[model samples]
Target: MQNSKWVDVAIVGAGLAGITCGQTLRQSGYTVAILEKSRGLGGRVATRRLMATCADHGAKFVEPQGEQTQQLIQQLCDRQLLQPWTAPIWTVDAAGTLTPTEPTPRYVAPEGMTAIAKVLAEGLDIRRQQRVVEIKSIDAQTWEFTTDSGEALPLQARSLVLAIPAPQAVPLLEPLVAKGLPTAVLETVRKAMFDPCITAIATYPAEQAAAWHRVGALQPLQHPVLRWVSRESQKRSMPGHEVCVLHSTPAFATQYIDAPTLETAGRAMLQAGAAWFPGMEKPQQLQLHRWRYGFARSPDPMLEPLPHAKTPIPLVITGDWCRGSNLESAVEAGVRAASLLEQWLNSGHD
Candidate 1:
């Protein structure tokens, strides 16, 4: 990107919302740039490879609740990037009793969760490892953004969209907050809470893998330690490898937030799962991932229609915390924010 020229928009946080906003803005003929804090794209939508196996450590699956999201899922399926798994997800109660609840078919990326974000970011101007430290309005028509690396990238546009979480967006908007905006808006942003989660990925020997298969121990709704588990190699477009992924319940994760050793937790989860597969053995390779802000608990209700102020600047905030806690909600929030921005830009108002 040319430093001298100004893009129409600068989107922060290259997660699902940021990427979706960029795609929509670009389609509307706006020159856009995306800044990401991570080394790679996809914030919470992450996937990892262990030895010869691949596993999804974040965002295990997606269920379309609305027509817009359903259409998006159809598009993804048409591209051969996602496939539907059986419905009625299994759940283990606090007493270790397993129950299955059938709902809509849960869809997972064939490769992994990150595959969906990768497909969305295609042909977009994404700058990884560039974390925005500050954002301020230069004037009525220009905005200035500075990265943590001490690089100043000025974006002169009629609108600005913040696709980061509500908690993170609060500090960034301190100046505006200090200016005495309505307490309700600020309170709503502050009230949005995010829950933490832990994912454990394990790999067993070929014989053990076959043994697990026979016992049907890896069913999505059968185990307590695992919210969703799948053979990585069995997925449609996933890399051919033997691996199993496990996601712990939010309640359990809160208990071990400060645990010294993750292995202890992993072992506990493995032991909890042993009842289903009596002969199951310990994994040869084990990995654990902790997510501090895994999902939102109380998301802002106004997320679908982002709030904007005419006096301050054309600043709009959006994220999964604003709408719902899922990939579809994040994308829908982005699209809605983009639409609001388009209207603001055209009307020359807030």
Candidate 2:
């Protein structure tokens, strides 16, 4: 995008939350621009290509439950970008005993989970890979930003929305905190917690997964290292090949959060997978992804001071953390932020 002097809104982080908020405010007829640090969209709903195969090492599926969320997923389905994924799953107990879980409706994209984000990104002024480093409030209504690149001057916007993780959002809003923001909001930001996860992607031989196709996914037993294991190829119904994504438990991720390398974390999770699937060939390819703020561990709204109204800077900060930690949660948080911003702007109140 060309350097615009100002915009109606300036959003930081182009993840699901940010994108959802963008869609909402756009419908409200507000000109918006988004700044994302990543090369592509979808913060946790990410995928990486492995040789000829691709693995969804981030968010696996979309379980849109509420009315609006259901409508959103239905749109993706009508577009043929997303298809229903009905894969039998098993839940393992603490003692390593496995029990088949009842069937549930799940959805997946043929290309990758990020397709949802791409769909939401249509007709939006999103500036990819622009890492916002600092935010300055010229006044209650005007805010300016500086990016990692020093080549350009500050970009201005009338309002701001933070669609990134809560932990990441808190530090960026520290300036507002020092500006005598509400104590309740400041406490929520300080106390909000996030749980990290290490995702491991491993590809086995073609025929190996089809043989055990009955088991679509695995919520492994009290395995210290592995928490979630699923075959992405099976989910995609791609015919042959077995590409699996393994997620480390919060405890395990925390333990290895400071591990030396990604390979180290990947190896640990891969070895654990070996135990569950015997005769499983050595991985043709293996990779690891670290999400420092993977899951929102914040208290429930009933427990914490998650007032839907009244925030600082006309800068509404939210993510999956305020609500539950899922694709659904992230989208809902974005809606809540947009709604609050709309009311705040309309009332001519701060």
Candidate 3:
């Protein structure tokens, strides 16, 4: 490969794992490029803004556990982009009765969940809307990738990494598979399954907001909706005082997996929520978000520590599935991938 245009590494998918890996490699003086198929960043950490109010349509909040995730959260908070929200949580039973639970503070981004991804992508060489169609190794020292737009991007590196989900990564390995890539890797990818979820965000009038809030916590784990109602206005960073977000139960989401439109499903959810609030009126701003690859149900914990090949591919697959479903798990997978890749690059053991 020619030296003029070749990068040291090419990261496919600008999700948490890809962004973290790019950041790590760049800090180590490696020329890296991130290819994101979507127009914006934040694969699962999606946020939507409406009429000056910000609501998280993807990941609602994060519960930090480890030092790395906690540190990341602290840095975001220091930037004045995130805040802690304390609200009584509830679980609805089958009979549609509400039951309040212990109040645990949930942290949310003031600007939105997408703000988190934007923060991470800062100063990184991320090429948005560049969809990588195929990856082929050119000799033992270089790799070439062709985009869906018929553009060729070549990388000359000692290593390469794939930070996308295992299922998404499998199709890209067709060339390697044809050349007889490890069966174990293929099998592991095939065995992984992601659960689906639907999130609904609705904005009611000020007059109706009080009626809904009176219930305190709606639907305490009885219906198809697990977490029934959260006052978006009560959230620290949310701008409006009339918005609310409702997350549907995984079972309900699966049942409606083939729903013709998300708007229909969202409308149905809003109707159900209104039942608990007697005086609740129709919402003005309603949106539905479908997470096709929401979370991992049962995953292989050992996938992260999988051994690399003798002629190691820079490809490393990481996501919430590799560990557990949550913001912390996503960050952990990213940090872990970075650490492992850093060690591999320094080992001199090709």
Which ranges of candidate 2 are over 4 A from the true structure? Answer: 1-3, 150-154, 237-240, 279-281, 302-312
lDDT for every model?
0.70, 0.76, 0.70
Residues 260-335, model 2: lDDT tens digits: 8877777778777766775443787777888898888846652222333233357777777777777777788878
Give lDDT: candidate 2, residue 338.
81
Off by over 4 Å in 1: 86-89, 94-104, 154-158, 179-184, 214-230, 236-241, 258-261, 277-281, 298-304
Candidate 1 vs 3: which has more TM-score: 3
Sort the predicted structures by TM-score, highest score first.
Answer: 2, 3, 1
- lDDT string for model 1 (131-196, tens) is 788877655556677888787864445557778877777777776655544555666677778877
Better of 2 and 3 by lDDT: 2
Give a tens-digit lDDT track for model 3, residues 1-350. Answer: 55536766777888876787678778887788888888988888887778777777777676676776788788888998878866665666777666776666567776777888888888888878878878776665556778888877644555566767676777877567655456666677677788777888888666666555544445446466545566667664443347777777777788776788887777777777776755333777778888777777646554666323434255566776777766667677777777776776677534
Q: Ranking under lDDT, best-scoring first?
A: 2, 3, 1
Candidate 3 Cα outliers beyond 4 Å, as residue runs: 1-4, 154-158, 214-222, 225-228, 236-241, 258-260, 278-281, 298-302, 306-312
Q: What's the distance in Å from true for residue 233, model 3?
A: 1.4
Alpha-carbon shift of residue 79 in model 1 (angstroms): 1.6
TM-score of candidate 1 on Cα atoms, chains taken together = 0.85
Which pairs clash (backbone N, Cα, C closer than 3 Å) in model 2?
none
